[model samples]
Target chain A: MAIIEVNGISKSFGSTQAVRNVSFDVSRGRIFGLLGPNGAGKTTAIRIINHIIIPDSGSVTINGIEAGPLTQRMIGYMPEERGLYKKMKVGEQLIYLARLKGMDYEDAKKATKYWLDRFEAAGWYNKTVGELSKGMSQKVQFIATIAHDPDIYIFDEPFSGLDPINSEMLKEIVLELKDRDKTILFSTHRMEQVEQMCDDICLFNNGRAVLKGDLREIKRSFGKNTINLEFQGNAGFLDELENVRINNRSTNFAEIRVLNGESMQGILKTAMEHTEIYKFERIEPSLTEIFISTVGEDNINPKELG
Target chain B: MNLRQILLVAKREYLTKVRTKAFILATVLIPLGMIAFIGVGVAFAVWESDSEHRIGIVDETGRIFPRLQSVNEQRYVDVSAASPDSLRQMVVGEHIDGYVTLGEKNISSNANPEFVYGGSGGLGLQTSIRSDLREAIREERLQRAGVSEEVKNIYDSQIGLDTRKLTAEGEETEDDTGFLTIIGVVMGVIIFISLFGYGGLLTRSVIEEKTNRIIEVIASSVKPVELLLGKMAGVGALGITQLAIWILAFMGLSAAAAPVAGLLMQDQLADASRLSDQTDEAVSNFDPAVLEIPSIDPLLIVYFVIFFILGYLIYSSLFAAIGAAVDSETDTQQFMAPIMVPIMIAYFIMLRAMESPDGSIAVIGSLIPFFSPIVMITRIAISEVPFWQIGTSLVLMTATFAGTIWLSAKIYSVGILSYGKSAGFRELLKWIRER
Candidate 1:
């Protein structure tokens, strides 16, 4: 069953329509990725689901109830632009947020302690947020997001400021939550993480959902015409290829996409002539390529997608 | 609509703010500082009045020397013999406080007698010396004209007008308009300090939450109105706590000060009471109660609290709205001016109208809803005001309060979510017009 469902929701701020006829769903125990460039209605759609902003039209339902204060209690949301009181201590802030999420003081205290220790930050409980390092505060922010034990969780760009180790830690925790059968939805501009983490995705662009489906099916629908190449030679032949685009490029490797009616062998022939090919294989297109081909170059945010 | 959530928010706000070091320091220090200031002033006055002076005389005209001896201030000053040239040396050697030199010339000439003093004399000392010289001159002229001392003494007494005020009901008392003006000033100052202190706190608190972005998380769980109200209630309760502490401290200081005052000012107290007793006898129906700067009327205290709460609510809501509209404290200046002008107008009008509390300007000013919160309380303090006027003022203000909160909540709902450039009035108006 769909744990949450959104149907034809539209929202506008003044004359700017932030979300237009956006619809998607997250099923039980599945991870839903909301993929978009910046200002592509992803945050707006998430805010509508959290009931922070009222939609101009249509509806959102969480566990069969309409989106509102009740649904808000059942969902833990960490916004893309995260903020916590700089002067407030880690312990007080966590407990305050927990209490707002409907936990009693005693329960909030207990949960705060449990999460602080789990995050290996029990010693930081009394320290003011301002005193913490950026990553440490992000740790506190993530704890605040999940300490209340909500049935569903929504995180917008949760890994933006995190280091690789902490990002990996967040990924593990998110997967752990899925193991406990909690529905999760997150928005991000990072395509690799979405491929690794999301069971389903709703790709947004220009305030509309341009593509969406189960990750496996979406990738399967785009036939195999891309090459993941790792070679130990000059990449000069990359300029000679026709009807293909090179991405994720490095001196030793590149992700090459073959356009329609263009054979992967033809690109391999050009690449072999210029250098030694250590490894080359015809493979299904990555979500990044699918995203690029579907949304188009003009739609991708250079700041985020580049 | 969740009262539990609202109260939780209120409790958190109150505890965090009141626990700050600045709050504790301000609450205890301001009142103690005021009392000490008043104490220093009283001590200076007493010390000045008690010190005696020893003055030397160098009257070149022997005709005036003997007449100066019988001067009334001779009891307070020891008038001694001295040479005209040595007068400065006398004062410099500490043998005399000062000396008056009357050169051998006409009394009405360029060489009018000069009185020079040594030591740091108070500002009023010169006026005393000048008046004393003029009095002696008058006495000398009167005696030369052969006028009786008894007649001259009677003519010297300056009798002021005995004025009183009468109500329409024929009840009359001594005019105390000056007393009323003092009350109005005190009341205005209290209102101004309170609204600025507490209302500014509310604004800063809102902006802090907005800037912190915690407001978004909090708002998801509670309505914007609840958040706004929760903050106002919390800060207001904290203000009341601080006010209560100050009042208790003031009462304790006043109680302790009375005995110390009696010990330090025993002579002055006795003289003041004797004068009051004499004045009591002179008036036909004099009551001892009128002598009292009436103890703070409990009714006046009640009025003060009501007006303070109402005034704070109005301004605090307006400030909170501004806080939501702007991203920073500096940006609030544009919106802040509009609200401040009305408060300033109310205060100035309160001060100006205090000259005639029952005048048409005061009466109308107290009835205008925005001004009523400050002006009406002032009018009540001065003289007997009608029940109908207070009722009318409260009704008008209560309606305005409701309207202000409603409008402010609308703006707050939209403004808190809006980040970046400071909003224009048109944007705020659009927010207000939105559902």
Candidate 2:
């Protein structure tokens, strides 16, 4: 069942349309990724889902109920613009935020401690957030966001400031939450993270969703029967294939892009005829390549709808 | 929001603030500082009173020297004889506080005698010496007239006049000192309640949310109004706690200081004792009526508590809203000035009420919700304010408080999450309209 469903959610800030007809859904237990470069309205859409902002049009439903304060409690949101009371102790801040989510004092404390321990941040319980390193503070904030054990979680750039080790730890935690059947939607510019972590993806560009689907499906659909070939004696491909483009060539390797209707076997035969092919394999598109092609190199510029 | 949730928010605000080292310091230091300041002030008053002034006695005819000696022994003045040049030299040398250089003419001549000192002469010393000289000259002239010493004493002695007033109920009363003392206490209480009670809450609440940034989190969770009121109530409870502590502390300090203050007041009371004794034998024999001043009125206490809470809620809500609206402590300066203006204006009107409780300005200001908290207390202290007026003012103040909370909450709802942008009147107005 879809835990969160957004339809045609549009918002504008003054003359700028921050989000236009933005729509997405998060089914139970899914890790949904909202992917975009900066200023692509992902943050605006997340805000609209979290009810931090009112959309200029459209509606959202949480757990089949219209959005309101009760639904707000069901969702845990970590905003992109990092906000934490710098002078407050990590434990105190977490418990306070937990209580706001309707946890009793003891339950809030228990949950706070549990999350703090899980994040290896129990040592930072008494330390003011201001004194913590950026990575440590991010860990504390991550704990705060999920401490209430909400059914739905929205994290915007949750891994932005973390070191590699901490980022891995966060990914594991996010996966753990997903395993527990918590619907999660997170926005990030890092497509590689989405490729590794997200089950479903929605890519936004210039205030609109440019590409979106199950991560595997989106990557699969972008594949053009391409073959990456590594060979020793290839001077040129002799322009022999009916429909093939040499996307890139190196000293001993060539990436051949075949037309949609062509087969990879044809490309492999062509490569074999042209040079001593050392390695030839059909390739699926990487999320990075697909994201670049769909969103365009300059994601900030508005795209003409085709 | 429910009361429990509001209190949850408030509790967070209060605990975060009160546990802060700065809040603890302010709470403890302010009262101690006030007591120390008053102690220093009293000590200075006593030291100034005790220091004897040196007066140069010219005594051109040598007739006033005996009187000067007798009066100087009373410890008010130290007298010395000097040549005119020596007197000027002594004044310049700072050997004396000041000197009264009597000329050959009667000391009470048209030209007021000049008192000289190293810098500016002390006015108290000059007045004391001049009065003593005049008394001495009068006695000498009276003796020269050949009146018997006993008769002259009778003629020189002052006849005291007793004063009495009847209230509207026809009860007799002593001089208006009792009323004036009540006025003083009222003014003190007004200042105490406004500054420490209400304004202190404002400062502490600002510091708390600033520390916790629960403000930011809550700004996202609930409307700014809920967060702000919750903060105000939470810190207001802390303020009330601190107020209770202070009231007890003050009672303790005053109880401790009273005997000492009494001892210091003994001289003035003794002088009064002497004058009272010289009246009719029955009057003199009677025990000094223990001043029979009315105690603080229970109704006034009730009014004080009610108005304090309401007034505090009004201003504190505004303060919290302002705190959320601004980004930093320095930015608060621009906003705080406007908030403080009403408080200050209320205080000045309270002062005016003290001088003339029934005056047009005092009455009008007291009827206004903003000024009523302080001014109504002043009125209740001195004269009997009509119950209907108190009721009307309270109703008006409560209504105003509710309206202010609603408006501030509108601003707070929008303003708390808003950062980097300096929220202006237009933005606040926009928020209100959005609401």
Candidate 3:
């Protein structure tokens, strides 16, 4: 079921068109990702869905209800530029936000306690946000977003400022939310995070969704001609490869995309000669390649496409 | 339109502010400051009056000197035995405040006596000495002219005018316009402080939220109008709380001191009754109530609160919008002038209203919404304000407040989310016009 259906919504700030003719659907019990580079209208689209910024045209519906304050209450939104009142105590701030989302005082307090304890931040309840470390406040903000237990959750760049440990913790919680059949939507340019989490995605380029669909199907549709090579040697031989394009290359790993009519086995053979291959496999193009190819292609030929 | 959300937001705003040190300081300090100001003035006056001056009279004409009595806290002593040089030395040595030499010409109409002194005496001391000398010279001249003491007493006596105010109902009451003006001035100052102090606080709070980037999170949960109103309600409630504390303190102080004031009134009345017994029995029929301080009309206080709330709502809404338009407190400077101009103008008009509450300017200003809160409250306190004018002013104020909130909410809704760009006048206008 389409829990959120955005129909060709457009928004502008002054003369800058922040979002243009953007349309997408987020399904129930699924993790949706809005993948785009900075200033590519991903944040703007998320805000529009949250009804923080009304679209200049078209409409958005959540569970058949038009996107507004009513629909807003059903969603837990952690904005890209998220923060808590620096002088407010962690517990009170969370409860305040929960109450604003329609929770009564008792319920808000209970939920706040549960979430703070879950994040292992029960001691931070009495501490002001200003006194908390950056990671600590980020966790508080996360708790504030979900304390009301909204059915649909929207997180914009939720992993941006987090350290690796907290990032993993956030991922685990998000996956746990998904396991409970909550519709989750998050926007990020970090492809690995999207790859590990999102079941569906809409790739945005210059305020337009250039590609969108089920993650597995989208990856499959790109074909399995790419070679994922992991080795232990200087990657200097990657520059000599013909009939292939190196999507990414590092000391021990390179994802080389095989051009049409090129064999992946031939590329693997070439790589094995220069370096010892611990692991090499033929696979479909990563989301990062598809993102770069789609958004990068649009960037290269701006006038023709824009 | 969610009442619960607005209440929740307002509750948070109120609690956060009320718990702050600044709020507690302001609430307690302002009344203490006013009391200190009045206490200082009274103490200075009492000290001035209590100061004593000692004078040495170098009288060449002994007849004129002996007739002079000690007056105006100045004491006279004979210094004729001392030489002119010694008298000067005495003054320099601080033996006396000053030495005044009276010659035979001092008794004449164009008398100019020489007074030698250190620079310690003020103009008040000199004026007192001159008046005392003139009185003695006049008495000497009158004695030489053979004028009787009875005639002199008649010549010195003066009459006083009794002031009364005739009401619209043709009843005369003791005039207390002076007291009323004091009330107006005090209330005007209170309103001024509350408007700017609380209004600025609201603006800074908005800027804080924007700077901290918490506004977007809150914005997603509530409508901008609701947020703005909740803040206004919260801050407004806080302001009222402070005002209530001050008013209660004043009332309590007055209640505690009323008996003492009444006792002082009775003392004055006793003096008047004694005078009346020596004069005519009809003079004793004077009403003692006329001498009593006029009590404040509770209705005026009610009007004050109403006007204050209306005024605060109107100004704070604009303050909130200004807060939203700018990213920081420093960026608010460009917008402050426009908002401040009206308040300043109203304050000036209120000053004029105190002098002549029924003047054409006062009447007009009191009816204009921007000026009415301060000006009309002053006018109402000073004299009888027509019910229609008060009714019209209240209506206009409410309507203006409603319109201001609507326009301000529009600017606020768009401005809070916008970042990086410091909003100019043109940008704010665009935001107000944006859908």
Q: Write the per-residue lDDT of candidate 2 for residues B1-435, one digit (tens) a residue.
A: 656668777887778777888777877997788679889999999988787656565555666667777767643243444666877777678665556555546643444556566655356766677777677777766766778879887967999877776766989975564565365445435444554355545654554454444444554465445566677877777777776677678667656665666554565556676788654444445443343333454665666677778778778777766766766656667777787787888878877777788889988898899878777777767776788889899999999999888888776666656666557666667777762
Ranking by DockQ: 3, 1, 2
The TM-scores of chain A alone, one per candidate, are: 0.95, 0.83, 0.92
Q: What are the per-residue Cα lDDT tens digits for candidate 1 across A265-302?
A: 77777778888889998788888888889988776766
Chain B TM-score by candidate, in order shown: 0.69, 0.74, 0.72
lDDT of each: 0.83, 0.72, 0.87
Q: What tens-digit string does per-residue lDDT give for candidate 1 at B117-226?
A: 78546667667766666676656567667888788988689998876989668989667767766776677667877777888898899999888888878877778998
Better candidate number, 1 or 3, judged by lDDT: 3
Docking class of 1: medium
By TM-score rank, best first, the candidates go 3, 1, 2
Candidates in order, interface RMSD in Å: 1.1, 2.9, 0.7
Measured against the true two-chain complex, the DockQ scores of the candidates, in the order shown, are 0.62, 0.37, 0.78
Candidate 3 chain B lowest-lDDT run of ten: B279-288
lDDT of 3 by residue, B1-435 (tens): 988888988999999999999899988888888889999999999998887778888788787767765443347888889998888888889988888888878776576887888977789889888888888877777877888999788766888877899978999987888898999888877887778888999999988888899999999899999999999999999999998988888777777676766667667767777877653453456454554557888999999999999999889999999999998899999998998998999999998988888999999999999888889999999999999999999999999999999989999999889877679999888988898
Off by over 4 Å in 3: A122-127, A231-234, A240-244, A260-279, A298-306, B41-160, B260-293
Candidate achieving the largest TM-score: 3
List pairs with backbone clashes in candidate 3: none
